[model samples]
Target: MQSAELQGILPGKLIHMLNLMRFNFNVRFISVLSLVN
Candidate 1:
């Protein structure tokens, strides 16, 4: 039962983490572009 719950939650958690990483990357990219300009 616990494992099943974890499995259900895992994809959401992974997507959340991926979103965070993408956001961080976008922020960094914008900062670099500003600095370059």
Candidate 2:
């Protein structure tokens, strides 16, 4: 029962983490671009 619940929740957690990483990357990229200009 706990394994089943973990299976359901893991993917959502992974996607949320991926989204946070992407957002941080975007912010860094924009900052670098502004500094160059």
Please give, for residues 1-37, the per-residue lDDT of candidate 2 as tens digits.
9999999999999999999999999999999999999
What lDDT score goes with residue 3 in model 1?
95
Q: Which pairs of residues have clashing backbones in candidate 1?
A: none
Evaluate residue 35 in candidate 1 and report its C-alpha lDDT on the 0 to 100 scale: 100
Off by over 4 Å in 2: none
Q: Report the Cα lDDT for residue 18, model 1.
A: 100
- What is candidate 1's local distance difference test score? 0.99
Model 2: worst 10 consecutive residues (lDDT sum) = 3-12
**Can you give the lDDT of residue 13 in candidate 1?**
100
